[model samples]
Target: MNTDVLVVGAGPTGLALGIDLARRGVDALVVEKADRLFPGSRGKGIQPRTMEVFDDLGVLDAILAVGGTYPVGMVWQDGERVGEHRMFDPAEPTEDSPYNAPWMVPQWRTQEVLFARLVELGGRVAFGREVVGFERADQEADGVTVRFAAGPDVRARYVVAADGGRSVVRRTLGIGMTGETVDPNPLLVADTRITGLDRDNWHIFPPRGEHAGYLSICPLAGTEDFQVVAQFPEGTRVDLSAEAIRAVVAARSHLAPESVTEVRWASDFRPRAALADRFRSGRVFLAGDAAHVHSPAGGQGLNTSVQDAYNLGWKLGAVLRGGAPAALLGTYEEERRPVAGQMLGISTGVHRGEVRRGEATRQLGLGYRESSLTEETRTAPAGLCAGDRAPDGKLAGVRLFDAFRGPHWTLVAVGVEAPELPESVRVVTGDEQPSYGKGLFLVRPDGYVGWAGEDTSRLADYLDRGVTR
Candidate 1:
């Protein structure tokens, strides 16, 4: 068997990459070790920047339809309702940034939505096909051969290891993860059907003892189940049984053991931050949890993982279908690894009370200003600059996001003459864009400003030497 790109794991990262490649008419095959999709609600918080990515991927409407904004946190003590506080700093939607708040959609439902979109685009996923190792391809082969535990070997032009933190492919490549434990305690997370809990606010229980940990029960949006999280002291053996979950809820909060009607799913893990030594090794690339594992604080792990796929998908499409050089692939690691490191720090800080869940957690400020691909030619740049995220707004009776949609680059020629370019690049001209002062901006397919300058020479040179169709 053969495929153009082989993607392991069917989580958000793999499914998203499959959708992007499918839209670009790239042949991508996603294989999962399990028989079905992940059934837990682990990564539930979807940041604002990821919402924009989903909008471009055609799943924004579905995601928004099924998800709701995060609720306020209500502190409780001795069964009495205390004062309430905001979980995240509220930000009103501006013309340039529409989705400014964090949305809540369980990790399971998010993956399901992405999988449905991938299927709609004619993408394929083979389940129960666990990747054992890679049958190293010769220099003349031009691709790698992947071996499975039970199925025949499959060859591909490139392999992406989205297999998760316990990534078999990453381990086979001999990549090392270096980091420290964010907290010395272990946390037990579960989805449960409980009585006596309002769906309006996230219930929080402060620690009663000096060594005791905290407890939180958040109403999972768009569902009847509540996500229960409880922390335990270091070296404590955490049990995942339904009975244990009920005991923890009863002991920590005012809820009775019988109030926990049912436990839908449960898991336990210690908070830790780790990053792979490298994201790419030869034709194989590591993405998502396989590349960096973050403490689920501030909801950075899954969002960062999905963006990793978003960043790599277009480059893969450009190299495979378009006439771009393979060196473009190297930028995936260079650009994403640093972003991953920053997100890891943010996650750790949020876990330890060193960072707040506001603009820093929104991820809109992340960029590639120093990337080799970015070219800032303007002597005195203003407002929007190179390598910044292309903000969303109206430009001369047209929406910038609408113009930037689809698998193509966009040239936002604001207050300047629009130049003739290849069909691969979409040009949007506006006399004045409030967010962007007079300038020519080259927006990449992933919606980041790749080149910014008043003159078209930098844009022409970038396309001629660095990018092409």
Candidate 2:
């Protein structure tokens, strides 16, 4: 089989990318080694920035329907209730930033939501198709032949290794990863059902002895299951059996062995933060956990991964389906790697209790200010700038997000003159916007401000220079 792009792995990253590509009429294939989507509740916190990406992807309503706001954390020690703990700092919604907090949705359910959206767009994901390796005559070649473990090799002009941290494609391409172990202790995470715990708050059990570590049980929003996290000292093997889980709950919290009624899915991993040395290897590009692995603290891993896909999907669509230069793909690494590095530090700091899950964890502040694609032509601007996220607001009876929705470019002319843009670049003219002050903003398909200026002369030049070709 042949395709324009072959996306490995059907996790959230691959599925989200496939959905974006499919909607743009790009011929893409998503394949998975496993027979079904991931069944765990890992990476459950959906940051506000990611929620914006979902809104553009046509899955925000469904995501909101299947998820709820995070509950307050209730602490316990020696079987006695203690004070409440807020996992994230509170922020009020504003006219520009509506989503102020993380939404609690099980990772598995998030994947299901994405998969359903992809299927709705007629995207295909083949299961049981494992990529063992890939081949190309030249390093910078036209196509790559990806060999599978159980099926015919597929050819693609570009390949994305969203296969995850232990990415077979990345390793096969000999890309080295640079990172360190964030925590020496091993941790266990499981989706379980408990009997005695109230679903109103996240139940926390502090370590009582030197040998024991912290344990927390958080009620999974929109479901009966509670996600259980337990830490063990270094060099100790974790038992994933139901009995071990029950015993752990009985020993740490006041809950008895019978409280853990069901252990649906469980996994163990040591906390670590790693990043691939390079995101692209010739025809293949690394995204999601394939590009960077986080400590899972402050819930940055999956959110970063989804944004990685969000950033790449539009660029790929531009090159393959919208007559853009292939060099447009180069900016993906330039824009995402630094963001990945920053998120890694945030995750590690949060893991070590040195950082708070506040504005940083929300991820709304992240942007590509230094990217080569960004052109800050304004001498002195206020509020939003080039390489910043285009804020959502209503102006002249038009919602900015409503205009920015779908796979298209948006030119927000707020209290400024207009430009003669191509038919592809949709223009939203407004007299005033508090977030945008007297400038022409060229918003990329991924919602980042690509160009900003006081005049329309440079706007056309930026768009004509292979940006909107």
Candidate 3:
């Protein structure tokens, strides 16, 4: 095999997966059809849960440096300031959740950061290479052969389709996507430099009459740019040219055409939500937009896609390097499919005004309680349970996150006698931790509690399920 894993498309999902695999010393390759990274601020809002994922991936510091909190929305009418609008409900940071609010970073900047990190980790992305077709190995234990449009065929133990909604690998594998259009009206989104707008507020212009639609201009944090989103009636051609965008801005808001200095990037799309019928097909797996597509209203698309990569990365590492059985990989689809479905509903709801961007949109409460991988052995569990996110705290003069930072399972003994764990697993012992009352928590590499109990009788068996001695 040319590599252990062949990740298609160099978007956020592919780059994130590449970074995760590279840190584990896995032989992986990322291929992109585009000549360069994405250039637009398409997915600008990063939710709080995704912030935690970024922390583990070692890019949280950079993300925080390049992004800022979402600005308060300012309403305008007849070229005058009308009132102030709040984009999200208020929330404060807690011990369990450090990032409390949504962060604003242009999607282009996020990709650039992930790409640089991937390169730093010794991972490579081959550009201008598109996958035309692929064939599975004749035997279940063998690898798959992938045919590219511009290069020789390559073989890999597994392939992941991180391509966008119009995924060629998914289509080639005959996987169907089921979804409905969230909004029939076309929306034009672009990144531009405007002179008349202030960077402190997200400017909003309500619809003037039956003929005119609403327009919003938000300052992209940490940069001299603004993201313009304008709605159009159904059946409109929705021109994306510079002149068309300037005309829209002038007609809908107080900004004159001359105030729009330059159009850096632009695109138009109809808001829609979709999910693939299946996430895995034999040796090929679907992730990011290939697995599910969400409307941009709630900012769940990119965050969910990044978590998908995070979930699959550790499992792939375990099976490839830790002597785990291949069936362990099936848990990825089982755990993430439901999450994609739930997030899709939330995105669609936020787009239709049926749900507010509140706790659900933050995604901090998401868990894998129903997965077969979770083992809640205790009859009465306190504080945390199997499948819940292991909260960060100080234990025995060491930070729990610091202990869980690297690519290894952490057996956290809080207010309990520690066990003699295998060398493959890292152990953290303490007399007490506030977030975790008094129990043994086995934190998975992905930062989820895989097993929790009052004793160590079942710990070894759980380790034998995946970890090698």
Candidate 4:
């Protein structure tokens, strides 16, 4: 059997890429080692950028309907409430954002959403199919032959190792993951229901000794269930026993120890930041944990993986259909590599703050306006840079469909003449109401700021960057 793209691992990244490819009428297969979906709330915070990606896939409303909105700001220190940060506010867009705030949902639920969409797109994940080896059809030619357990050899023009950090595909390709796995600190992670607690805010506890942790409580989307998170010293671990969880809850929430019930899931793991020197070798590409791994400081690990899949999906689809150049795939690494590097840096700072119990890391400093793929930064003001995710807002008198509409190339014309704009571009009048800002804007298929200007001088180049002339 063969496919256009054989994605190893059916996690969020692999499933997302599969869905995108299938939606564009490309043949792709997602092979997972596990017999069934992994159940648990590994990482729960979804970023604003990720929500916009969901919108592009036409599943944002369903995911949001299942997941509750977490609009409260974050607090510093454990239980001390030194300061705050807002999750979703209408007042943040710089005249061009498409999403007002991020949504909070469990990792498992996120996979469920993507999986359902993949099925709708005519792509199904082949579970219990493990990819154990890789072969080169030609030394210089970049085609790969993949071997799976108890199945015929599957030959593909391209293969992506969306397998986890400890990827067998990466190892088979002789790709070395160079980074430190050092765990000077260890922490326990658990998912359970705490009956008595305010579901609105994320509660963090004060620092304890050389180690620190927070109790994360958020409403599980579409249920009365509340997911809980508690951290301990690097050397400390979670005791899943009722008494253990109860004691921790009582101390953290100042509630009765018996109030904590239903110990659903739990685990212990250390944190590490590792990145592959290269994301692609020949016809094989690495994504998700296969390409990079970092601490879940900003809840970015899953989101980054999704973005990686998004970046590769369309390029792969276009290349397979002969609509775009193969070199478009090169931009995946060029764009995501630096983003991963920056994420590692920021996560390190976040962990350092948690370890030392220092003040919360300032979030305003975390923007990706430095990437070359971001045309907005080129035309942005003095302080602006590329690599940042585009912002979102609502248009007045527009139906709900128009609000979240468009995988099209969006151009918001300011004072510039709109009548002269090409028919290929979807141009909209700039929004200047109290809920929205004003400026010429362009959004990519994957929800990044592609072009923004007060004039048409840069519009030609911006449109050319995403598609072939």
Candidate 5:
């Protein structure tokens, strides 16, 4: 095998996994067909859930340095002031969690940050190298054979297909994406700089009857520009004519036609919500866009992809380091498939709900009930409210000596006797003896709280499962 792990496509998902593998001193190869990193901006908003993933990689602060913080959250009905929802603030951190706010950054910038981290960790992404083909010998000891555009066949013990929606790896393995492909009609998405429009908040408008139009406008970081996305009614041709776009903007925002000027960049494409039938086949695993594709309804496409990478990254590293079993890697599919399915259904529903009011928590409140690590917390009421990512609060003023200080297994103790601090466990306590309640909790390496029961003794059995010796 040319490498222990071969990751196809060097997008955010692949790079994130590569960085974690490199940090663990594992031999991993990240291959991309594109000659260079992405230059275009696709997804713009980075939710708090995704920030926690980056935090574990020790790149969250650097990402924040390049990204802008937008305290303003989602809006209802055409950017109307009414019915506004605010993102959780991070100013106050508790023992329960750490990241409480989302940051705004372009998808391209995120890839750049991950790539830099990968290089620093001694992993390099070979660009212009595509996995034209692959062949698996067996289920467990499968050897992935890949043919570069002009290079010779390269084989690896495992291959991860992060090759976007139309994944060649998935197709080669005969994996079908099973889901509804709604609203096939063309939609306009632009990453241009809007001069007259200036607002930190997300601007959205439901399409009105007859004159149908939708709008999403927010500021881009490190510049005086804003990313504007406007979706016209089905059958409306998205053209280069400035007059055409201005008319759509004016109609939606009720702004003067003359107020709109300059189109930095724009494109037209249809959005769909789809997920692969299976996340793994033989030794090849599918992830990110390759595993699932969905409408940018809640601005979830990019964030979901990054989150996918985060989930698989550590598992791959642990397995390669002989610290975990091969079955541990298989859990990647079992854990993430349902998540992608839920996200697809919820996000698409959120987009459609824009036209019609419906129950909206499915899109925003995702709690992980399928994970074995979260089984104890599943019955707990404090953190396991829904199937969304777990929320994080600050740790008042406790000090740890590392950069991303909370990577170790966190064992939070409450009224019950606290568990003995294992070598790899980080203990979060109060002024005196450890005290925990609704605000107190423990955090796993992947940022999920393994044990959330008020009883701290539960952690001993929880961590014993696989967290500690």
Candidate 6:
């Protein structure tokens, strides 16, 4: 095989998966059709759960340094400030959950950071190389061969399609997508530089009368630019040129046409939520937008995509390097397809004003409770259970997150007799952990609790299914 994994597309999902595999010492290659990284502030909001995933991938520090909290929304009408609107429900940071709010970092900057981290880990991306078609090996151990539009055919044990919604790979594999348009009205989104608006608040302008649409201009954190969003009529053709953007701002708000100085990037779309019929087909797997497409409403698209990579990365690594059965890779679709469906619903609800961006949008509550990999051995469970996220807290002298911060499982024996675990798995013994209560919590490499029990009778059997001693 040419490589263990071939990741198509160099977006956030592909780069993140590359970083994970490189750190695991897996031979992988990322190929992108574009000559350069994406250049837009489209998916700007990073949810709290994704922040935890970044922490594990070794990019949280840079992400925190470059991103900032979302500002309060300010309403305007006839050039007068009317009221202030809070974008998200306020939540305080607790010991178990340190990141309580959404972070603002342009999608372009997030990709750049992930790319830098991937390069630092010795992973490389081949630009301008697009996949035209691929075929699975006739024999299970022979691997798959992929043909590119401008390069020679490449072979790999597995291939991940991270290419966007219009995925040629998905189409070639005969996969169908099912979804509906979340909004009939066409919306315009742009990144621009304006002079008259203050950077302190997210400016909002409601419709003036029966004819006009609403406009919102938000200052993107960590950058000297603003993201402008406007709604148009059902069949109105949205203009994206710099002059057109300036005209929209001038006609909708108090800002003059000349106040809009530079137009960095602009695009138009009608919000839609979609999910692929299947996430896997033999040796090929679909992830990110290829598997599911969401409305940008609740900021779930990018966060969900990043978590998809995080979930699939470790399973692939374990199958290839940890002597686990190939069937372990099948759990990716089983565990993530339901999550993608739920997130799609949330995004659509937020778009239709049927839901609020509160606990659900934070994504900390999402887990794999119904997954086949989750083993809840305890007859009577307590605070935390299998498939729940292992909350972060100080246990004894070591932080739980510090112990769980790598590509390895963690056995946390809190106020219980510890068992002999595999050398590959890390152990943290503590007298008491407030969030976890008293029990044995087996934290997976992806930061979810894989098993919870009162004793170690079945722990060894669980380990035998995956990791080797």
lDDT at residue 238 of model 4 (Cα atoms):
59
Q: Report clash pairs, candidate 6.
A: none
Q: Relative to the unseen true structure, what is the C-alpha lDDT of residue 44 in candidate 4, on a scale of 0 to 100?
A: 72
User: Each prediction's Cα lDDT score?
Assistant: 0.93, 0.93, 0.91, 0.67, 0.68, 0.92
Each model's backbone clash number: 0, 0, 0, 22, 13, 0
Clash-forming residue pairs, model 3: none
Per-residue error for 277 in candidate 3, Å, reads 0.6
- Of the two candidates 2 and 3, the one with more favorable TM-score, higher being better, is 2
The positional error of residue 360 in candidate 2, measured at the CA in angstroms, is: 0.6
TM-score for model 6? 0.98
Which of the predicted structures, 1 or 3, would earn the higher lDDT when compared with the native? Answer: 1
Give TM-scores for every candidate, taking all chains together and pairing residue i with residue i.
0.99, 0.99, 0.98, 0.77, 0.79, 0.98
TM accuracy, model 1: 0.99
Question: Which tens-of-lDDT digit does each residue in 116-178 have in candidate 4?
Answer: 999987997998888888786542475668888867777777898999889998888788876
- List candidate 2 stretches off by more than 4 Å: none
Let me know the TM-score candidate 3 reaches against the reference structure.
0.98
- CA lDDT, candidate 1, residue 182: 95
In model 5, how many backbone clashes occur? 13
* Per-residue C-alpha lDDT of model 1 across residues 1-469, encoded as one tens digit per residue: 8888999999999999999999999999999999999999999999999999999999999999888999999999999988997878889889999999999999999999999999999999999999998876541368999889998999999999999999999999899999999988999999999999999999999998988889999999999989999999999999999999999999999989999999999999999999999999888999999999999999999999999999999999999999799899999999999999999999999999999999999999999999998989988787788999999998888899999999999999889998889988999998989988888999999999999988776678888964656
